[model samples]
Target: MLVHVRSDGVNAKYNEELATECLVWINQVTGGSVNTAGDMDNFYEVLKDGTLLCQLVNSIQSGIVKKVNNSKMAFKCMENINAFLEAARQLGVPAQETFQTVDLWERQNLNSVVICLQSLGRKAGNYGKPSIGPKEAEKNERVFSEEKLKAGQTIIGLQMGSNKGANQSGINFGNTRHM
Candidate 1:
């Protein structure tokens, strides 16, 4: 049987000596050495220095293993439950027999949780793609043509002698609007 202990009380604030004693106690119980930082050098030159770093690193490594084992157990349990459900479906089992094997309400909740986890993973995967900033809408203003005249596209109603379009002559200075 796997021992499941809540980590609410185990934290880093414990004294280094006490933590080392706790590490020894845990290793004695769990058959795993709490020595993850055997290769790291101490800040000081003393050979047995940085005991706190060793304890913390070992504790972290053990915690990581425990976490991985817990997840694997959970996945195995889910897989077993699903397999039992599939076998029940195949054998045309009664509802009373399968109801005790798996709770449908809990299974529905687990399904929603799986969907949420999948969405989170998808969002994480999409985070690496480049983001495009908002683009402004282009205004539809008129564009003037810059083409050569080609003998037919000149402005209409203009004569050759520069007399202001065939009406005025010889510079009359009174009517400013007409000028």
Candidate 2:
């Protein structure tokens, strides 16, 4: 796959073909085609993974979908009925429990953690841009002053710096007197 590394440090890409395919897939999945690309790539990933759990988690973290609160519960309730969490609960035990477990999991699975965090839908702080302008353009015009030299005045290389012409010949001209 041809990937263009962006100049900026952020790891984001704009793949033309993938986007088009995603749009088509979205139309096929949803009974009615949606207006935006938000759910398109997600639905595609769900097909690849054979489940919608991951996408659902992403939506929750992104704040696109909010979780309903349990009024009686002391702890903050999860907004969405995450299938992955349900599956884990159904299983005999959960591997992750303590803060250490969560920290270790985050370190190992950075991408998944990012998706989960985004599902929370918290408003992030703004890092504003600075007011800076472009530098002034340099003048290419050359300035030269005449100087007196002996009869054996020598001229070397072309005045204009052409890479091709310089390589072919050692020097353009030998000895010369002012015209």
Candidate 3:
């Protein structure tokens, strides 16, 4: 019993209120450091980028193909559908069944995108937990590691020089004495 919001008549005041609330929540969760002053404006500018929407569409299309042709492939398709639905739910979009036909799923996905955009716009600030503190770099210790440079083994083709210029008469390279 998921309630679907119509995208055709989205309320501007509602969106603005949701966006402001989302910003406040984001500030609360992330300590107001995740986004710069104008980042939210930039986000609203690119909200309709359609990258994720296109990915969802492709997943649905592929799943539909698999469902019609091969049962094994269809299982993979179902997994894709389930993943999309789960992600949508996590983003506050309503439930959409994988059992539905591809056409229905496509329409539902489109609706889900609109819903997700609205929900995200409203709750973006509240999504993630604040960092406790800076994380320490991991140190790995290994026994019997391979030797990088063995003793008494000089790298070849390297030039060595003395500041006294006494060795300038001779072309001395590295530890090798060239006479």
Candidate 4:
């Protein structure tokens, strides 16, 4: 791959490595049909139609996509991508983690697509499915009794700062600009 100086440089360093991991994970989950996604262009070609993406999501949870369009029509392929994204969201992937249809279909910002797949992998792991990325982001929901809530109201929040030794004299900003 030729280096393009005027590109999104942030992910340029690790995008290839991360994309490779995503491709491996997708193949593992979807029965290994994808042959090669060694680079961004190849990755786009492999997933541009969205069939494999939908299949991987379906394998994670049956019928999440409802349907996967296999036609070559432009609309059909974009729909497939949309379907896959909806399914991924149903599987607990965050909305921000999914890429727009144009990103893959128009071959723009494919790195976002790679990130989406990586997020899907983590979400799949959370649901006890096969995953490829780091550990799933677990929710830590806390429950507080009424007493605890009342105690919290009495205590000053750290954001408000401590006012134990308050004074009337505060630094005035130019004496309030009196005429």
Give the best candidate by lDDT. 4
lDDT of 1 by residue, 112-169 (tens): 2222212222222233322122232356897555665444566554554455466546
- Colliding pairs, model 3: 22-122, 25-125, 26-125, 26-126
- How do all models score by TM-score? 0.17, 0.20, 0.24, 0.72
lDDT of 3: 0.37
- Distance from true position, residue 114, model 4, in Å? 1.0
C-alpha RMSD for every candidate: 26.6, 22.4, 21.0, 5.4
Per-model lDDT: 0.31, 0.31, 0.37, 0.80
Cα error, residue 77 of model 3, in Å, equals: 22
lDDT for 101 in candidate 2 is 22
What value of lDDT does candidate 4 attain over all alpha carbons? 0.80
Tell me the number of clashing residue pairs for each predicted model.
0, 7, 4, 0
Residue 75, candidate 4: C-alpha displacement in angstroms: 1.1
Residue pairs in candidate 4 whose N, alpha carbon or C atoms collide under 3 angstroms:
none
Write the residue-wise lDDT of candidate 4 on 10-112 in tens digits. Answer: 3364377788888888878877767555687678778989899989988888788887898989899999999998888888778998888987887767778
Task: Give me candidate 1's TM-score against the actual structure.
Answer: 0.17
lDDT of 3 at 68: 21
